[model samples]
Target: MAQALAAAGARVLVVEPNAPHRLPGLLGAAAPPPEGQGQVAPGIWGLFLDPEIAMAAYLRSQVRVRAIAERMVRSKIYQRFVAAAPGLKELIVLGKVMMVYRGRHQVAGVGGFDQVILDAPATGHGVQLLRVPRLTLDTFGESPLTREARRVQEMLQAESTFVDVVTLAEEMPVNEALELEKTTRDLLDFQVGSLIVNGLCPPIGEAAAAWDPGELRADPRIAGAHYAATWCDARRRMQQQHLRRARAATRAPLECLPFVFSADEREVVAHLAAQLRATGASRREAC
Candidate 1:
């Protein structure tokens, strides 16, 4: 989503809280070549500031980083991405991204930009991070951290952004997706913007088209029409079941990322932008 937002002409500030390369390739090659690369794409600025400070400045500095990162990414365009990605602007994101900044849910940083897409971690950890701002606000009573926290919270609650959550599209992911939503409502008390079901599906509809209905209950002109139909039906039903659950489970809109059985991640981000455009999300947000 960082790539997607950046492509749409937003100054992106990627906050990274995880240990550098603790889990390499998580960000993938979704990065532009080193400065030597061709004219890099627009609307992205990643700064991987480590939360543990293994790579970041420090405990105090990390707080500053969150506000700065948020301020950098708030684009007013109110649109979804629609362009070729430039990969990473630099090797670093803003800060320890893998960690969520608690009580800092309302991001006032990355100010002036229209949107702020956090590559935040899961609910268990992420929720805890988001609550920090609120906690500090209650305890600190109008300190600088509290000010930043409220801003971050507002952004997260912004109609345009809901501490939007991103997780793999699987049983655990889906369950986490819900838990994230509920936790936000009950604990942080914010509504998440959308649930992105990433890399989902085995292409039931297309596979069904491959089989011949008439060939079924016959001498089998094909490999096995009956079996194919059953498989396709089951798969389609499963896909629908997920969709139904998404609709039924939470109030947040569910977005599907077509099963990329074998498509480049770069292509996936591009396609995602296109799909969002077609759905008028970009335009609607603009309004």
Candidate 2:
């Protein structure tokens, strides 16, 4: 997202523990666009912020984030952020992205430009990450960390920050998404941001016939794995349905990203960027 947003003319600073991968393909599949390429292209710079450990790591890293910001702040491409993006809705996801790395338990470093879009890890660890603020508040009651947790918790509670929980469109993913969303609402009082129902098979306009010619029809291939290709359309439709139901069950509205067949490096990055850019949720809510 940092690379993609930078491509769209934003000063994007990505804070990693060590050196950046230098390309999206390493993380998934996108290639970074040219630097200082004008509003036609945004500037993306990376900073190392790992050594931070535990809730204490959340301590304002302004001294560190400031240095990187100073370098890119001069770029004309970055000036776009200074203006009022009347179209930009304030994004509502305050992520306590307690991501574990190098076998470390708590998030070693915490940072994002104006908005920290944490592509959080899987369901198992995601819970701990989101709960850091609350947990830290409980453990270290009135200390600086507690104060930090309070600030974090306030952001989480405010409309500005949502404890976002994402999942694939499958059953297990759906179950996890629902659990996380409700848990966030109940425990943290952070309204779940839009439920991101990822991995959805997009609507196949002409391929709708795979369902049936009339009201209802059964395909024998559906029951047999040997004819998997024959029933793929049916499975795709089922996937879509599952995604919808899961989103409907959550406090956050559902936002779906089409299932892309292109996993190629450059293609993956471009596609994800396109998907993010195209999401009405981002545009509608105002960030």
Candidate 3:
């Protein structure tokens, strides 16, 4: 999706908050030159959001005191404090995200980004992350950080910000997605923009069913092929059943992404992006 948006001429920055899923190491291995931000593909850039780096960068941007910010970041006191704080780290991570979303960065220049996609934490952690700012405001009253937290909270609740939930067409995940949607709406009052049902199997059940298995079973060469088709058809039917249940559960715009048979991550992203564009979910203009 980020790739497609970038391809469409949007200034795309993919933010990976989860340390493990960060692309820098993978991209560096593929193409040398280690950096905070690297071009993962044509027009698409990826940034690994190390909390300390983000906090330092954020401080430098706000205070215009790079040396002080750098020193503060390296200080054991600051590190321990940040580590001990319940949601301070998450808040800083999101602050960096808001900065990017607003197109404000000390090193990257002061132009706005057309699109900023966050590979946010899983549903439960994500909800807590979103709630931190509000919680901070309630607890801390009106400090600088709390003020910034309020701003982040406002941005989150703003009409421009849209949250899209991606889930597999399975009972557990679908139920979880629905719970997440309801919980987000109840707590944050943020309605999900869309429910993306991923890895949907193609409708091959009818075609497989129509084939005369008896004729193919007699031929040893095609027997395996027939069995594989039948298995695939069963999977497809199961997927369709889950799809129906997902649709019935929510009134939000639902989009189904077909399972892409590709080993390459780029190919999968490109395929999903195309599907998003086709569904009119890829809005070119930045909010």
Model 2 TM-score is: 0.59
Collision pairs in model 3: none
Q: What is every candidate's alpha-carbon RMSD to the true fold?
A: 12.0, 13.1, 3.9
lDDT of 2 by residue, 7-91 (tens): 5665554433212434434334244323211111235443333222211223233226765655544545544542332211111
Position 280, candidate 1: lDDT: 50
Candidate 3 runs further than 4 Å off: 21-34, 56-76, 210-212, 215-221, 282-287
**What's the C-alpha lDDT at position 164 in model 1?**
64
The worst-scoring run of ten residues by lDDT in candidate 3 lies at 24-33
Question: Best TM-score goes to which candidate?
Answer: 3
| Candidate 1: RMSD to truth | 12.0
Q: What is the TM-score of each candidate against the true structure?
A: 0.59, 0.59, 0.85
* Number of the top lDDT candidate: 3
Regions of model 2 farther than 4 Å from truth:
1-4, 13-41, 45-112, 203-231, 281-287
| lDDT value, residue 86 of candidate 2 | 20
Per-residue accuracy of model 3 over 239-263 as CA lDDT, tens digit each: 8788889888875678778898788
